[model samples]
Target: MQPIRVLLADDHPLFRSGLKNVLQADPAFNIIGEASRGDEALLLARGCKPDLVIMDVSMPVMDGIECTRQLKEHDPSIKVLMLSTYSDDAYWQESMEAGASGYVLKRAVDTELIIAIRAVMEGERYIYPTLLGGFHKPGGKAAADELQEEVLSPREQEVLLLIALGHTQQEIAEQLAVSIKTVDSYKTRIREKLNLTKRSDMVRYALKHNIISDKTV
Candidate 1:
């Protein structure tokens, strides 16, 4: 039996340290590395290639949402579990859009996190029980077409779509049959057209404009 390798990423050092101890207490999880910022999380995640990332939704220099998007782009196989204090459905919505496997509220029972991690590793999506009533599932092609008309080109729209789904340029390139440069170009154009000021801002716009469904974005 292979042990599950886990990486802890959060801006709060004490929280991460405490979480590390909590996870290490469980024999099934192995703490492989720790990161204090979104950028560091991306770098460590890429290098360590951990099986699971337990991350915070809020962080500096990059938020967990964008970091998770980049991570999934780098390695779609890696599972991400978002640990957050926010009850805002937007976080839940954005996290799912960013390809996070699970969303666990920090105040939930300790076992909830465990369950979420295990479920994600087993190829399942876990959401906090309290949030289920409000999770909005988007309509079909009509909704997609509305998002498509947001001043982005066909390719740029595709890139924005993938970004909403938590794919990075490299991942989007392979998925769209384009080069990384091509994906970047599309992203640049999309950002400019959308008037997005930051990578995170692009995600927020995708969320605000309903470019991606609430459940996914």
Candidate 2:
């Protein structure tokens, strides 16, 4: 199988070097090129046509969000995984709107970054679990206000909570003492009942309904 071609984009040289080193150690990834600015990244991307671009949110010339927008516009097939220090929901929302396939925080990069990259490469969107906490304000009424009247079964609620807490289908099955196929069925039912098609949307719903507390996970 061909290695996943990747382009690194970050203004900081040291950080870029560190990321390149880490990615290089993984045989699945190939460092096709590196860019120190968003504009440079755009130019390099056009030339290298990498399968993925690991980009910093903040950069000179143009920000990662704008660069991602332009890159997607130029070639919709290119995947972008945003690496950022920011945990703000606004930044997360903006990155998603700008066509990011995944968002991983700098703090959790060592542990979660590779998982996020693989998830996106496999055609699944990846959002850092820590950032999901921002969807609900502490002691605020936003979550209560947004809560839906539709009720879920006990098993479905348990599955939803686990999913929102970042459990994989296999893990959830193991935890709940159910089969993987059963977990998938529960997820499908949850999505249909809530009218949610994206994992992020289900996460938000879980928060709003107090199914999963930010502090708990």
TM-score of each: 0.62, 0.66
Q: Write the per-residue lDDT of candidate 2 for residues 1-217, one digit (tens) a residue.
A: 9999999999999999999999999898999999999999999999999999999999999999999999999999999999999999899789988999888899878876775786678666767755654565554654423432223545667889998888999999899876787688668656655667887888887887788877866
Global lDDT scores for all candidate models: 0.77, 0.82
Clashes of 1: 3
lDDT over C-alpha atoms for residue 45 of model 2? 99
Q: Pick the candidate with the highest lDDT.
A: 2
The collision pairs in model 2 are none
- Give per-residue CA lDDT, model 1, range 115-202, as digits (tens): 5675578676666655544434497644543443422444455578788778877899899876786677556546544546576776
In model 1, what is the error at residue 113, expressed in angstroms? 0.9
Candidate 2, poorest ten consecutive residues by summed lDDT? 142-151
